[model samples]
Target: MKEYKYTINGTKYEVAVGDIEENIVTVTVNGEEYKVEMEKEAEPEKKKPVLGKPAAAAASTSDEPATNKAAVNKNNAVKAPLPGVITDIKVAVGDEVQVGDTIVVLEAMKMANNLQAEKAGKVTAVCVKIGESVMEDDALVVIE
Candidate 1:
């Protein structure tokens, strides 16, 4: 059972909800008890669509030869830590960055996160733009 107090038009009312079984519920208001029948089940709120590379694609890359992976990663590509949309790019091509410098602002799970540089280098490529979505491990920038 749950209790709630509400004030409307300067009048205070106490409500208690008890025994909700399917569409029917036992409810009490003030000092009166009644059985209430819900008109219909409440629809759940819609969720935002998740856009990015699927897990299978990310897993398949691990099966490639180590040499090929190392060659591609030699440029110091700064990858996304998680799936998110690029809210802002703090650096651009040719920009110099030191370790721990903020490189990009990513929005994930309704929070903005500052993605920092892992190593000092000059930016050679900006792989994603503001509003572009990226998956975990997707390169957002490349430095050399």
Candidate 2:
């Protein structure tokens, strides 16, 4: 099954699509299952990418890093307080920032939350881009 997480009207939903047939699909939304009919038959598709536990474990067993999702650049880093999409980044690399400065804006639960600098420092790295979804405690920017 293919899974997708979405936030709509401030509500979060996890949808799984699978067992597709001619013009019908099975979808599970937030634990509730539904059989949906499509307007037309879906076209043949290519293979899906593999990006799950097995692949990650295989990568970790090798010399290379398991993934690039958890990179930290500096000792000082601003992390996401909750799961959300990064709507904007106010500071660029080498930009000086003071405590309480709004470094980034995150959209969660249909609200805009400002991510501020914890201390005065220069921005060393921006780890997320616009429209990127971040999880709680994910490092957003590094300051030094």
Candidate 3:
């Protein structure tokens, strides 16, 4: 028997291959039986090798003022309160929204929570899309 590890959404499981015939594969994971289908392996991603000096250091030294301005502008960003998957996005960019408007619906712990806007402003950006998982204090939107 050959053992393999499978990871899905950060959860890992150890599986043992049992029998293979035609396109069907029978396997066991943690004492549970599963039948799977064989699929072709995807091609490896080609990496571009960097030969010159790092661009980050040069960009930082040249754009210090612009970077500071951008940081100051992001002070009004709206963030998520908890770790959850964004189930819905209610408002779009350029939409004028008032305080307490439902900006997004987050699903956490098997419950749907309505994330409301804290202040009146036009939505400058909606950061997360539907079915995207976010962590606590992660930026969800930028209202300006």
Candidate 4:
């Protein structure tokens, strides 16, 4: 699945592309899923080379750390408040946190927003890494 966020005419939309079969595609927008059929199959675009390292590559190769999502308690996961790129992670697995403690820093619209914990607990999962982009409701951490 590929996720993307867009804002048009002051309306924000979170989109996720699921599968593609021939001219039909499965997509989800703002929590609503839909199947869209194309008029015809379009040719694939050629790749353009010779540029600096791509953002995705840089993010993957960065030293920033992340915890294993498979071990996360989904019920206790701390979800993102809005769409943004993760600028920093302030807590790690096994760390103790208090209510209102900044757990992550999210950069949205050029402003860094500190996402704080809602309840006190021990951090059990760090679902996002620095430079990673996330949409509203995406899980960033898990505390229990």
Per-residue CA lDDT of model 4 for 53-116, tens digit only, reads: 2644674774443436655667888899899988778888899999999998888887889999
Report model 4's TM-score to 2 decimal places: 0.55
Error of 4 at 58 (Å): 9.3
Per-candidate Cα lDDT values, in order, are 0.79, 0.79, 0.75, 0.82
Model 1 segments more than 4 A misplaced: 1-75
Best by TM-score: 4
TM-score of 3: 0.50
Among residues 3 or more apart in sequence or in different chains, the pairs in candidate 4 whose N, CA or C atoms overlap within 3 Å are none
Worst 10 residues of 2 by lDDT: 60-69
* Candidate 1 residue lDDT tens string, 1-144: 999999999999999999988889999999899999989966899966434335324534554323344445534798999999877778877899999999988999999899999999998777766666789998888778
Give the worst 10-residue stretch by lDDT in candidate 3: 48-57
- Model 2 Cα lDDT, one tens digit per residue, 1-144: 999999999999999998988879999999999999989846799844332335434534654221323565545789999999877778887899999999998889878899999999888777776666789988888888
Task: Name the candidate that leads on lDDT.
Answer: 4
lDDT-wise, the better of 2 and 3 is 2
Cand. 2 TM to true fold: 0.51
